[model samples]
Target: MTVLILGGTSEAVALDQLLADQAPEIRAVVSLAGHTSDPKPLNLPVRVGGFGGIEGLRHYLIENRVVAVVDATHPFAAIMPFHAEAACKAENVPLIAIRRESWKPRPGDRWRSVPDISAAVETLGKPPRRVFLTVGRLELPAFADAPQHHYLVRVIEPIGDRLPLNGVKVIQQRGPFEADEEEDLMRREGIEILVSKNSGGPATVGKLTAARRLGLPVIMVERPPKPDVATVDHIDQVLPWLVAQGIFVTERGV
Candidate 1:
């Protein structure tokens, strides 16, 4: 059996590791979108770049003889799910989506949830005097319309490319940031507002806590919905489900 994982996020890495350890007999391949600087290395076969479109993906699946596809991509990765659904259907290949649940506002957390980035930008109301943008490099263009505000943008990789806005200050840094450091940065930069995607995980949750501590409002953009497919939130659940579906033999019985 051959399995292909549409990967990019940390969860994707975990899923890949789980699959390899539990089902070494099944060949696994992970496809990355090539948007990150230091993507986690996988022990399995890896492919980088888009599959062009639905037809292109169908061709790849057919050629590779991929029996199952696991869409373990970022929740915010909207288009890939649509393509995966279409391609898998056309090729008669089984598909599953592994998505992490979105984060919810806790007690004392000030959050304004928006459906999308454009809505988030509009919800900012008047231009904030100082803003912290943690939305990543791919979606930075959405803030171009809010050029009136001074933005302190943080990204994992250095952006050698020019941004559409001129009033932006770039901070090239990796994540897993500390809450204390996040608070200090916001204070020193005089940030009154925060703009971020509701990417639920602990590595980047420090900024949200920092914003809440300083009473700063966060314009949180909700993740895009996944396409029609069997989906699971945890690796253990997915492994059992896959075995039940005959994608792999149950380890205990086998």
Candidate 2:
């Protein structure tokens, strides 16, 4: 059986690796959105770029004989999941979503949750003097109208083009950053407000802690609902499930 993974996030990478290691008999392919400058290498075969749309994805699945699809894209990757769901349904292919759990406010955490970026912006009230934007490059456009605030935007890749906001400062960096570093950055930048997606992972959790420590209000955009599919939160759960479904004979280390 062949499996196609709609991928980009670290969870996708881990899932691909786990599948390869545990189910070598099953052909696995990772599909990247090609939005990042330097995406991590995958252990299995990969396909980059959008699958056009639902129709295109269905065509690819039919042509490639992909029996199953594992959507491990970013939680806020709204359109891709919709496309995947439609394509899989049309093609009659089994589908699953590996969604990372959203982060909740802890005992000391001060978070202002909003359903979307627009709502978050509204909740911010007036323009903050100094804002740390941890939202990805794609969502930066939403903040263009809020140009009165000085933005310290951090991204994994260097933004080649100028942002719509005049006072935007870009920082190109990957995560798993230390809490101390985040705190120091907040201090140095004189950040009074933080805007971030509630992307729950160790890589970027430091920012949340930093915001809490400095008593800065964070406009946390809530994650979207996972696509309708058999879902799992961890890689270990997937292998056994696949085996039970007769997708693989036994665990074959990749």
Candidate 3:
């Protein structure tokens, strides 16, 4: 009689709050990947770290009696959604993914879309450029191959000895940054090129807007393939879907 929420995004937090306020009888648990050391606290029951793999996840759904699962992880996440789909199927539990829409280029956006991170490095070319890197801490090492470019890396977690390049500057901060501030940073750093993942959320999208205003070329890394499952873009839609699934039954008569 529990709903397992695979959480890491802002959408997950909103959904958790919504359920807590509206569906008081339902037992909802938020599971985090533990990417950030000090993740924002949520009111619902929270579980941290991975469930090993697919077999481990399958065991969790069975043991916890998880009737449904919501995949609200980050778009850049490549593996977890597939694993959730498989595990939920194995357990005969319903699964839904909150697939945020990818950002489309506007009139002034100078974008070069590539399939993955490696291709992005290849796109950077041999000549050194002042690169604004926002693809997160996990994939920072990939830039090691293209060490000639100076990288301005911003991450939520401290990137200690992760990228051993000579001209790399690390800034640890959380986002939903203003476009004016983003523009100022880019101009001050003399950024020639911007490298970012098409993560498709407002929290970090100010970089793209700033880039567009400053007329900087962006090497956008596209999201990896995720398993096709029941999907929606917003958090508000989740509770209705759960109710429709009969996971949260309503009592009749007065």
Candidate 4:
């Protein structure tokens, strides 16, 4: 039986690893949106790029005879979750999402939450301040309007000429960064504010911690609403769900 995973996150990698080790009989494919130029290798077969839309995805599901789908896209992914929900329902396939929780402000966090990236730009106002941007390369264009501020952009992939800012420096790096390192970067760069999406994961939470230590104001872009579907926060729960669907075989006979 075939399973399709809408993947791009660390959680997706973990779930794929679990399936590879524990359920060898279940054939799984990991689908990426092709954002990262050099994504790390995975155990399962990986398909990069889009599935067109709902109609295209629906066709792929029917053609592949996929028994299930796991939506493990990024938290800020605004379209794919809805498309997956619609396509899976049409194909009569069991679908589940690994919806990671949003980060909440702690006692020392000086956060200013905004609905979206545009709002975050507006919050920066007319005054020029050194800003550290961790909201990915795709969202960088919106900051062009606020060109007065110096921006330190950290992305996994090269930004090229996407962000047309007057004073901006791009650092291509992937992370599970430490808080002390993050603090040092902020201090050295003279970052006055931080602009980040509420992409809740342990891999990149150090920036928030460092911001708290430095008492830097952060412009937190809240997550967009995800499609209402069967969801779990942890990757551990996925195998049991797959077993219950009768797609995963277990030696313990779960």
Which tens-of-lDDT digit does each residue in 43-82 have in candidate 2? 9998889888999999999999988888888888989998
The digit string of per-residue lDDT tens for model 3 on 134-165 reads: 98999998999998999999999999888998
Q: How accurate is candidate 3 locally (lDDT)?
A: 0.92
TM-score of 4: 0.98
All candidates: CA RMSD (Å): 1.8, 2.2, 1.7, 0.8
lDDT of 1 by residue, 112-198 (tens): 889998997788777456889898887777777777888899998776653567768999887788899999999999999999999
Q: What TM-score does model 1 achieve against the real structure?
A: 0.92
lDDT of each: 0.85, 0.84, 0.92, 0.93
Worst 10 residues of 3 by lDDT: 245-254
**Which residue pairs clash within candidate 4?**
none
lDDT of 2: 0.84
Q: Of 1 and 4, which scores higher on TM-score?
A: 4
lDDT measured at residue 65 in model 3 versus the true structure, 0 to 100: 91
lDDT of 4 at 252: 90
Q: What ranking emerges by lDDT with the best candidate at the front?
A: 4, 3, 1, 2
Index of the highest-lDDT prediction: 4
Worst 10 residues of 4 by lDDT: 158-167
Q: How many residue pairs clash (N, CA or C atoms closer than 3 angstroms) in each of the candidate models, in the order given?
A: 0, 1, 0, 0
